[model samples]
Target: MLHLRVVCPQGRTADVTGVLRDEPGVAHLVVHPGVAVHPAGDLVEADVARECADDLLGRLADLGIDHDGGITLEQLDTVLSDRADAAEEAAPGDGADAVVWDELINRTGEESRLSLSFLTFLTIACLLAAIGAVTDSPVTVVGAMVLGPEFGPMAAVAVGLVLRRRDLVTRGAVALAAGFPLAMLVTALATLLFDAAGWLTADALDALDQVDFIYEVGPFSLLVALLAGAAGMLSLTSAKSSVLVGVFISVTTVPAAAFASVAAIEGRWSEAGQSVLQLGVNVVGVVVAAALVLLLARSRSRRRGADRALSDG
Candidate 1:
C-alpha cells in the first residue's frame, strides 16, 4: 500500500478531494483545509494500494494539485483495520524503506573508493584469472569474477545517463577507466615480483596464451551483460537487495577486467586486447539495458499521474 500526502490551493481542494475519492485503490481519505503555508492551501491525505499509486499521482497532476503542492507516497507493508487486530497483527510502516537514488550512488562511490584503497583485491582477482587461465578452471574464473568490483561504476554510468546526472556519469567513467589500468599496473608489478621469487615462469605465461575464452567476444556475451544489467537495476529498485549480490557475480565485467590485467602482466598484447574488448562489451551492454529500464520506470510514473488526473475528471 502507498500513503499519499497532497497539498493543493484552497479553491482546488474539492476537485482534488473528489479525484482522490473516485480513484481506485485509494482509501481512508482525509482533507485538512487551508493547512499548507508554502502554497497556502489545503492538504489531502489518503492511503492507496501500491498498484494504483502511479495512476493516482497522474490523476492528481491532471487536477493541477501538484502545481499548488506536492505528493509523497510512503509504502505501507502491513494493514490492520480493527484496533483489536493490532494485538496479533503488527501495524504497517514498520519496515525500513527501499534505498533511493542518493543512497545507491553514495554506496557505489564508497565501494569504488574502497576497492581502490589497496591493490590487494585487484591483484588477487588478476592472479586468480591468471591461475584460471593456466589451469582452465571455470570455478576459479568465476571466483575471480566475484572478487572483482568493476560493475559499480558501470552501473553508475547507466544510472547517470538515464537521470541526466552529469556528476554521476563523470565519477562513474573515471572510476571505470582508472580501475582497469590501475589493476593492470598493479598486476604487472606483482608479476615482476612473482617472477623474481620464482613463483611465475615462462611456462605460466605460455599457459595463459593457451586459454581460449578471453578472445571469444560475440553478441551472446553482450546479451548476457544486457540481461545482467537489467537484473541489476531491478535489484536496486526492489525492496529485496540481497538479490543484487548474486547479480554482482553473474556479470562478466569484473572477470574480463581481471583477465585484461593478467594479460597485460604476462605481456600478451593480443590477449589483452581481447580482454579489453570483453570489458567494453559488458560495460556497453549493461549501460544500454539499465538506461532502458530507468526510462521505462519513469514513463510508468508519468502514466500513473495521467491516470490520477482522469480519475479526478
Candidate 2:
C-alpha cells in the first residue's frame, strides 16, 4: 500500500473528490477543506493500494492538480486497517507485483546521479576487485560485485528507454560514460603503484586459477547477465532488497572492469581486451534485458488496469 497526500484547489475540489470516491482501491480518504495555506487549497489524504497507485496518480495528473497544487506518494510500511486489506483485494493486481513508475523513476534518478559518493563507491569496489584478481580470491570478487553501485544507473538507463524520457537516458548514459572509465583509469594507476611497491606480483596473477572467470567471456556470462538484470529490475520494483543483492552478486561487471585495468597495467594486452569485452557484453545484456522486463511489466499492468475498468463499467 501507499499513502497519498494531495493539495487540491477550491475550484477543483469536487472533481478531485469525485475521482477519489470512485476509486475502489482507495481507503480512508479524508478531505479537510481550506486547510492548505501555502498552496491555498484543501488537504486531502488517502491510502491507495499499490497496484492501483500508478493508475490513480495518472488520473490525478490529468486533472491539473500537479500544476495548481501538489501530490505526494509514500510507501506504507504498516497499515493495520481492514480498509487497507479490502482496498488491496479490490485492486486489479497484487501490491507485491506492482510497478509504481513514479517511485521507480524517482529512486533510480537519484541513485544514478554522478555524485562523489557514487564515484567513491565504484572506485573502491574496483580496487577491491583488482586485489581479488591478483590473489584469486572469489570472496573478495563477490564483495566488489556487491559493493559496486553501477546497477542503479544501469537500471535508470533501462527505465529511461522504456519511458522515452531523454533526461533520464542522458543522465544515466553520462554517468556510465564518465564513471567506468574514470574508475578504471584510477585503478590502473593504482595497480602500477602497488606493483612497484611490491604489493602485487606477476607470479600471483599467473597462479590465479579460481577467479579466471573475471577475464573470460564464457558462454554463460551474457545469459547470467540477462537473468540478473531482469531480476534486478523486478527486485527494484518489488522492494526485494535481498533478491537485489543476489542480482548484484550474479553479474560480472565489476570484476571485469577491475581485471581489465589490472591486466592492462601489467601489460597483459590480450587479457585486458577480453576483460573489456566481457564488461561491455555484461552491461549491454543487463540494459537490454532490464528494458525488456520493464516494458512487459508496464504493458501487463496497463492491460490489467484496462480490463478492470471494463469490468467496473
Candidate 3:
C-alpha cells in the first residue's frame, strides 16, 4: 500500500476529495481543510492500493492537481486496518507485482545522477576488480561485482528509453559516459602504482587464470547479461532488494572494466581490447534486455487496466 498526501488550493479541494472518495482502492481518507500554508488550501491524505496507484494518480492529474498543488507518495510496510485490507482485495494485482511508474522513474532518476558518491563507488569497485585481476583473486573479483554501482544508471537508461523520458535517458547516458572512463583511468593509475611497488606485476597477471572470464566475451556472456538485466528491472519495479542483489553479482561489467584497465597498465593491449569488448557486450545485453522487459510489463499493465475499466463500466 501507499500513503498519499496532497496539498490542495482553496478552490480545488472538493475536486481532489471527490477523486479520493471515488477511488475504490483508497482507504482511510482524511481531509484537513484550510490547513495548508504554502499551497494555502487543504491537506488531504489517503491510503491507496499499489495496483491502483497509477490510475488514481492519473485521475488526479487530469484534474490538474499536479499543477495546482502537490502530491506525495510513501510506501507503507504494514497496513493494519481492515479497510486497507479491503482496498487491497479490491485492487487487480498483488502489491508486490505492481509498478508505480512515477515511483520507479523518480528512484531511477535520483540513482542515475552524476554525483560524487557514484563516482567514488564506481572507482573503488573498479580498483578492487583490478587488484583481483592482478592477484588472481576470485573472491575479490566477486566482491567487486557486488560493489559495482553501474547498474543503476544503465537501468535508468533502459527505463527512460521505454518510457520516452528524454531527461532520464540523457542523464543516465551522461553518467555512464563520464563515470566508466573516469573509474577506469583511476584504476589504471592505481594498478601502475602497485606495479611500481613490486606488489603485483604483469607476471602475476600472467599467473592469474581464475579471473580470465572477465576478459572472455562469448555468447553465454550476453545470455547471462540478458537474463540478469531482466531480473534486475523486475526486482526494481517489484521492490525486491534480494533479487536486485543477485542481479548485481551476476554481471561481469565491473570486472571487465577493471581487468581492461589493469591490462592496459601492464602494456597487454590485446587483453585490454578483449576486456573492453566484454564490457561492451555485457552493457548492451543489459540495457536491451531491461528495456524489453519494461516494455512488456507496461503493455501488460495497460491491457489489464483497459479490461478493468470495461468491467467497471
What residue runs in model 3 are displaced by over 4 Å at the alpha carbon?
none
Candidate 3 lDDT over 1-313, as tens digits, reads: 8999998887888888898888788999999999999868899999999998988888888988888889999989888999999998987878888888888999999999999999999999999998887878899999999998999999999999999999999999999899999999999889878978888777777787798899988899999999999999998898786897888888999999988988998888989999999999988899999999999889988998899889879
The candidate 3 region of ten consecutive residues with least summed lDDT is: 200-209
* Every model's TM-score: 0.66, 0.96, 0.97
* Deviation from native of the Cα of residue 57 in model 1, angstroms: 11
Taking all chains together, the TM-score of candidate 2 against the true structure is 0.96
Worst 10 residues of 1 by lDDT: 87-96
Candidate 2: worst 10 consecutive residues by lDDT?
199-208
Model 1: colliding residue pairs:
54-304, 55-304, 55-308, 57-305, 58-304, 58-305, 58-306, 58-309, 59-308, 59-309
Candidate 2, residue 74: Cα displacement in angstroms equals 1.0
Model 2: per-residue lDDT, tens digit, 1-313? Answer: 8899999898888888888888889999999999999989999999999888888888899999999999999888899999989988988778888998988999999999999999999999999999888888899999999999999889999999999988888888898888899899999999989999998876668888999998888879999999999999998888776898998898998889999999888888888999999999999999999999999999998798789779879
Identify the leading candidate in terms of TM-score.
Answer: 3
What is the lDDT of every predicted structure here?
A: 0.68, 0.90, 0.90
